[model samples]
Target: MKKMRERTRLIIQLAFAALTNGYVSGFLGQKLYKGKLKQFCLPGLNCYSCPGALGSCPIGALQAVAGDRSFSFSFYVMGCLVMLGALIGRLVCGFLCPFGLVQDLMYKIPVPKVLRKIPGDRYLRFLKYIILVLMVLVLPDRVTNIIGQGDPWFCKWICPSGTLLGGVPQVLSTPALQASLGFLFSWKMGILILVLALSSVNYRPFCKYLCPLGAIYGLCNPVSLYHLEVDKEKCTRCGACSRACGMGVDVPKAPNSPECIRCGKCASVCPHDALQFRFVHRKKEKHGQAENIEN
Candidate 1:
């Protein structure tokens, strides 16, 4: 039953992504409105340069601010993401992000190899923080040009999502863009290629170590309205949930750990039915109170 639910969730997520990208809307509307339906934006990290993309990407919006130096905070886009993350945590990453969904599907290619496990050092995970502070935020603004202009460092130098969905496709489709590719384009494209190749073996290297959006959303997970709980009384500590987790969360220890993407895989795999995916804002427990009060 749980497996069925998981598959259903996956299908629904994929369907939503497909429909919102204007793929379906564009195709259907072309018959009536002469390609006028290509003006919407989905809630996830979809490439604006994608032929099917109806709206701008959130990361791209952030990059525009960091890159322009003259721009202000993207209130509309940032508000949307914050509201979504606060409500769902990284459930968006696990279930909704198109790029994440693509990576998850790629890892299912059924190669005969052991799962790639990173060292379990809690500190090493801070690398994403460093990336966010330096690469995503600091570098772009610091490297200002003579005109006091900055560039979107991550989008120009790193972003695999842009490279895969925007850069590659646009370059392929438009001869003008292809002819203008410089050494930077090659460099970014190379990184994207490497990531795509590695994604087949590793689950989500982008989300784990690079994605600034993932980092931001992950911070909200520990206290987000939506969370996963393990009823310790029912849990046997069998580690089944942990073993089944794709995000490498120690389910028995901290099911709502920041590293958890709230994918529900662990909860679904729990045999004792001790795990639950529910909405709960975690609160401080009083010194001696055993009551599980909903705060």
Candidate 2:
């Protein structure tokens, strides 16, 4: 059953990836899709610079609005993202993101996993929120040049997704881009390589510890309409759900934990049928906390 759920999730991930990046001619021409559809935002973290991307990435769009000329806030970007997040929360990370699919595929490579859980992982999880604040929010608003145009700090300096999906392909396919490649490209490439290596050993390292988009969606998990509900009456408190969770969420105890991606592994593994994803919250009893087995 767990395998079936995983397979289904994989299919959804692929479908979303294709739907967002379906522009074949863009890749053929080695140029980004300069289309009208780029006006909109995708629910997951995709690269705006990806040659085939049909729509703007939410984080990229948000940063652009925050940092560009007017330097004003964008209700359009924020409102759209928040509304999408309210519907499914970090389910975007689990089954919709392009880079997430890459990480999932990398983790499947049999390499005798060396780092399933990072040391001090609980502290490490806080890194994404810090990136969200400093790189995404703070730096974009504060740091600017004479014209007062702030660069997209997160995309330029941090996002492995852009490096992989955009930088690599664009550089490889375009001679002008290749000639113009400098330290920034090398730096992002290093980050992408490091992330790929880590993904082979750790499941969704970027999603778990680096993605600002995940951090935003995670914040919505507690109040999202689609959320996990643990049936206290049915739960045996065996820690089965926690054991099965790839994101290290202690499911029975904190069903709507901010870190949860709603991957449904907990739902698939709950032996007593204790945990499930619900559209509406049901009655939950106060109970003993489940230890984070994977953490």
Candidate 3:
């Protein structure tokens, strides 16, 4: 079964999420983890404030530097993300992101999928890039508090992952935090509800249309060492691969498309057995016989 083929990937997702958020005592005690492990960043979009999070989110760490009073840069965070992306592209989205797992589970609910086949979805995919540049990058550095420290704009304003996994848990645990919840928390909750609702009808709506971290990984798809390859001679121009792609990637045409999450669905459904993932090493091939799909 198609689902069975993806079981390994699903298990990886669950495992990585659990590993990054393994502070059981923090959850039990209603305290966010503040150990030395929190100094390092997780490769996926796990919430930093989640009571059980043992590591900080890379996106949140980047924003902390970007929004600092000194406007310091975060080579550590950026380098970490780049290193991970270079190793496997957005495989992080497919097999590590906590929010991605949430969306995947939501999609299992029986419902009419109203958003997957919608028009102009391709255009919407670009929204994440805009958010990466504006909310994550520009606003955080440009907008500062009275003391000149900037807020983590994306975390404060738009990250549903933070709202659901971090904000909700923190508020529920700490009575004082609950009392301090204001319009910002309400806004974040609304966004979280909307994102969850959309996830039930769309595969990874947040990853496709809103995740800044995904946008960064997507860019690294072209240069990632791990990639999908196609044997052009074996291909019959059939569209089975594309059809299996929940991300709507035109596999064979663009096997390494930024939108590809490394879900491996396209490869699994290739009737010709023409598709496969490969590392940098490769045998010499005849011209035009087969190649890695271009951007």
Best by lDDT: 3
How big is the positional error of residue 144 in model 3, measured in Å on the Cα after superposition?
0.9
lDDT of 3 by residue, 1-295 (tens): 4678789888888888888888999889977777798889888899888888989988898989998887566788889899999999998899989999999999989999877864778798899999998888888888888988888989999999999889888888889988898999999999999999989998888999999999999999978999988877677889999988888888888889999999898888888888878886466446644343332
lDDT tens digits, residue span 26-125, model 2: 8898677898999999888899888899999988888888888786666898898788789988888888999999999999999987898999899999
Q: What is the lDDT of candidate 1?
A: 0.72
- Per-residue lDDT for 1-295 in model 1, tens only? 7679778878977886776565544343322123444333355667666656766677776656666757544555567778877888888788778888878877878885354765653565787777766766676667788976677776777788888776776677668877899998989879887877767887787788778778878888777788887676678889998888767788877766778887778878788998887785445467533233221
Q: Which of candidates 2 and 3 is the stronger one according to TM-score?
A: 3
What lDDT would each prediction earn against the true structure? Answer: 0.72, 0.86, 0.87
The candidate 2 region of ten consecutive residues with least summed lDDT is 286-295
> Predictions ranked by lDDT, top down?
3, 2, 1
User: After superposition, which runs of candidate 3 have C-alpha atoms over 4 Å from their true positions?
Assistant: 286-295
Preferred candidate (lDDT higher): 2 or 3: 3
lDDT of 2: 0.86
Clashes by residue pair, model 1: 40-54, 40-55, 41-55
